[model samples]
Target: MQTMRPNPSRSDHKAIALMYLAFFVLGLVGSMTGPLVPALRHIFALDFRQAMAAQWLVLVVIGALAWPAARLMQSWGVFRLLCLALGLMAAGCLAVSFAAGSGYFASVLLALAVIATGTTLLQVAGNPLTTALGAPEKSHARLALAQGFNSLGVLGGVHLGSSLMLGQDAAQGVQLTYGILAVLTLAGLAMFLCGGKAFPTSALANETAAPSEALTSRWAWAGAAAIALYVGAEGAIGSIMINFLHQPHVLNLPMAEAGRASAKIYWGGALAGRFAGSWLLTRYRAPRLLGLMAALACALCLTVAVTQGPMAGYAALAIGLCNAIMFPTIFSLTLARSKAPASAVSGLLCTAIAGGALISILVGEMADHTGLAQAFLVPLVAYGLIALFAALKPAIWPQG
Candidate 1:
């Protein structure tokens, strides 16, 4: 069998579009779980800790699974891995729906873990594949565009979850939504399996490539750390926003209204920021652009932490705009200069995705003890580190 290699064929536009569509669907499936967070809390009568644990369960599983999945892509190729991921997501979605209907909290949590496992694999494979397909200088813009489609998926996920689950009996509405997501998962699986031959094969021929021999060194771990912290900071802020806004002496917005408004503003900011980033990368250096965005994010996190009412929520939402470019920018910067081992290093960087799990838990604990207002400080620390990394532009090459 012929080994797959990255193609610079601009004629493969259809393949590019299909990859973006797959990413869009992946984004939709991932964020669909967000709006369901409140419903899960109500149905299980879970305190903040338990509810947050359920979400983190998925993130931890995804992080744990990413390295193995990267290895699998080396053997099976991206299309097959995508198929496996979609199938897992489908099965997990169906299991969660049934568990919700049966009021089985443990079962629901397990199902979410399953779904996350698949999505993590898809992420590990898909992102690197996209960057590899495009030109060196254009990689950031391509990733930004692909991720913009992801933003649209998030917007739709929130809208779908809100329309279906909000104000309805929590159990039934939530169950139906999961069921719908399951259908979408299956559809995605079928499409990807049929399109199997289009995507490039993994960058590593096998997982055993000597660390020092590889062109793209694990030194990119610096960039990966930034990504993990970035994800954690983003998740922490969004996860706590509703609870923060509802506190008696905090923002004090009504629960139902605040939840919906918060979702809109947060995703709205994400959407706007990604579009702007796509345009900016065409002109500016990614490292400089990332530093500016991190600074803006720090300022916004502080604004949300200290202010109250609509102002606080809006400030929090604006952080999404600052966040929009950081991930793709960091990813492009890290991988752009890399050579043969880009895929393996991509998988390594992808593990930082677990940040969503860890950061949120830390913030949740802080909220439990110090109050949501103070917990916001957790991400502030992360953003500061991210800023320093942005300034350094550390090399991904191996040193003796």
Candidate 2:
């Protein structure tokens, strides 16, 4: 097994700042599906399963592109890859803005695929870069801190996206919102172009393993499964939250208000937890804390499954807090333990995120057939599996 030794000098503050900005924008763009669901449903006359197809498409593109993106990063370097991704995201946003009221659902999906492609590249480059920009011992804490900024982006994105895209004039709102996002993405692209030299050019540039090498490592497969389950559970819960809260048995808020509440309570909890988790990772063992959070998230999902009214709604929302540390912790822990190259392992992990689409589709089917509350059983099982993974000895501590 080869250990990824972090060079303290490569941990440049400018590079770290750039990574944070990238993560923040990624969060903002990545979180659009949940807030945009109601508008999409209204526009397309979609059912639960149909509405979920939007998210499915996004994750599917991400999975499909993860490997290629990793290979490209290996050759082109992170800075160039990031620049390309940002440009693609901006172009995709502009296309979406144009297609908003054109009444062509396929156009929207196509635009979203483009956006997902950009997002895949960003994640492929950003995750390893963040880890490389700091000490290996502090990888967990540093990644969590970056993810905190990501959550901050999610918090603001959800609020503004929901308010704009879920309004009375949904089409106009979509056009205006995405148009603004296009401009913002272009601004990020300009920043990266001008500050390209600030990024550590040599970081992770030596990881030349074929993607198949990652498949041979048990740690890679195990970590992939954990990432899949975590992403699936989180996506399923978030995708259905607004509709769940709008149910007669729950808060019964309007679609717009429900979206706002989901933003405030659900994603907001994640924001707080990520910041807090960043600090806690420095003081605690990463896997132990991950296990604790997964267990609590599982318990909360159970409450949502069996309970009714505000209790169930809040319980579902509270899962975000428990989810805050899971992704970064699982990722950093896997990197520490895996025998595979960092790029290969990262590509595998990002590919696993496509499981979110599958889980979300299942939840949608369950919501259509078994009822929304019972649909939480899917994520509950996922969180339980993650907890079990965390309890494994190899996962609990780094190998020598």
Candidate 3:
């Protein structure tokens, strides 16, 4: 790997700022569904599973494009690729703004698919590059910092959608909200282009290397499964929090209030946890923390599944605290475990994020058949799997 710049220049700082901005935007746009679930259902006249299908499309694209993105990143480099992803996001937002006016569900879905395509590429480039920008030993901390901004974006976006996109007129709300997103995306693209010369793409060197070791490692696969389950479980939980809180027997807030509530508990907890996790990972073994957090998340989900009222609400919210460090921790641990290059391991791990689609769909369907609270069993199971992976990580990678 190319060594990082010990003393970054002015342009390098600009590049880092733009990259982190892109990460924030990714979280903002990606988490839109959770808060807008009520709007999607009301506007489209759909059920739980149908509204949840929005994520299915996004994750499908992410999974499909992430693995091949290593070659693309190699050819284009991070700066150019990020600019392209921002452009794609802007275009998707533009499409959404227009499509939403007509209340056409298909158009919005298509726009999100395009957005996810860009996001997948961005993640493939951004996640590892954060570590590359500094010392290698601090990768876990750096990734946590990137994901901290992502969590902030999620918190902001959810509240934004709740206020602007969920109301008596869903189409109007979407139009206004997405119009703002498009403009912001374009602005981000412009800023990145001006400083584009400073960004490096050394990780893209994965293209020149063999993937045999990464492909063969059991720890790699185990880590992939752990990531998949973690994402899936998080998605499942996010997808339901609005509706779960909307239940009259539970929090019983209106859709907007429910969304605000979820943002505070779900995304807010993540935002705080990630910033703290950045420091915590420096003090603790990544796998041990991962196992403990996953176990705690499992307990929280189980509590949500079986309980009601404020207890359930508190439990569900607490899960985000446990979830805060899992992704970056898992990514860093898996990267260490892999014998392949950073870029190759990043692609595989990014693709495994498709678990969100599969698991969220299952949770949604279960909600349709059973109840929203009980449907949380799906994430409960997922968290359990991740906990198992964390606990057995030493067995899986005894040499470490």
Top candidate on TM-score is 2
**If the candidates were sorted by their lDDT against the true structure, best first, what order would they fall in?**
2, 3, 1
Off by over 4 Å in 1: 1-7, 200-218, 247-256, 337-340, 394-400
Among the numbered candidates, top lDDT falls to 2
Predictions ranked by TM-score, top down?
A: 2, 3, 1
Q: Write one digit per residue (lDDT tens) for candidate 2, span 269-311.
A: 9999999999999999998999999999989999999999999
lDDT for model 1, please. Answer: 0.73
Off by over 4 Å in 3: 1-14, 201-207, 210-213, 394-400
lDDT, model 3? 0.80
Tens-digit lDDT track for model 1 on 155-237? Answer: 77766776666555878877787899899878877776676666554433443442223324544667778888887887667
In order of appearance, the predictions have TM-scores of: 0.90, 0.96, 0.94
Give the residue spans of candidate 2 off by over 4 A: 1-7, 395-400
How accurate locally, in lDDT, is each candidate? Answer: 0.73, 0.86, 0.80
Question: After aligning candidate 1 to the native by TM-score, how far in Å is the CA of 297 from where it should be?
Answer: 0.9
User: Which run of 10 residues does model 1 get worst, by summed lDDT?
Assistant: 206-215
RMSD of 2: 1.8
Which lDDT tens digits does candidate 3 get at residues 1-400? 3234555556656666776788898888778878666788888898998888786778878888887776677677777778888888888888877877676788888988888888988888887777667666777888898899999989988888888877888878988888888887788788787877777544344445433345666667777788888888887788788888889888888988988888888889999999999999888888788889988988888888888999998898788899999999888877766666777777877788886688988988999999998888888888888878777745545632
TM-score of 3: 0.94
